[model samples]
Target: MTRDIRQAAAKANSPEYMSLWAGQGLRLANDQPAASTVKQTIDEASIFVQRFLTMRNS
Candidate 1:
């Protein structure tokens, strides 16, 4: 998921998505000994999916 974020960030220049990934990355960076990074990535991806759906619907 982190890789996905990196890939998306690398391919696109969306500040909102970038910020979301950055925030998730920061949270992951801060958590120690816990597998929170994956969860964070999942949450971030879910947000992206929802945004995409909203845009499509609109």
Candidate 2:
């Protein structure tokens, strides 16, 4: 479903992204995380989640 964005943004007004979202009115924000940071965060979260699940199931 295509809808209008009341506020203005670069991508919203850029002709390069005219084909973006296929007119779905959905915007993909640029969020490129650092590889090392992402990996470290994921590792930390995975360990916490594993421990929590194990404790809960005990």
Candidate 3:
């Protein structure tokens, strides 16, 4: 195997690999349906936009 592949495989097999590499945001992510995730993201953006517009208008 190539050096990069060997290093990746070794990292994948290590116990500390995920804990050392994964960010705090990783815990908030889920294996949900793509469409559902997209909808939720859009809904969150909509709420933020609404609040921003309201603030600008006031």
Highest TM-score scorer? 3
Instruction: Output the number of the lDDT-best candidate.
Output: 3
Per-residue lDDT of candidate 1, residues 1-58 (tens digit): 5777756876887554454534555654664455676777889999999999999999
TM-score per model over all chains: 0.44, 0.43, 0.57
Query: Please, what are the lDDT tens digits per residue for candidate 3 over residues 1-58?
Result: 3666657767789543333566789988899999999999999999999999999999
Clashing pairs in 1: none
Judging by TM-score, tell me the better candidate of 1 and 2.
Answer: 1
The sequence of per-residue lDDT tens digits that candidate 2 reaches over residues 1-58 is 2233323334477554233454543364246668976887899999999999999999
Give the distance in Å from residue 1's predicted Cα in candidate 2 to where it truly belongs.
Answer: 32
The candidate, 1 or 3, that scores higher on lDDT is: 3
Worst 10-residue lDDT window, candidate 3: 14-23
- Order of models, best lDDT first: 3, 1, 2
Instruction: List candidate 3 segments past 4 Å from native.
Output: 1-22
Which candidate do you rate higher for TM-score, 2 or 3?
3
User: Candidate 2's error at 42, in angstroms?
Assistant: 0.8
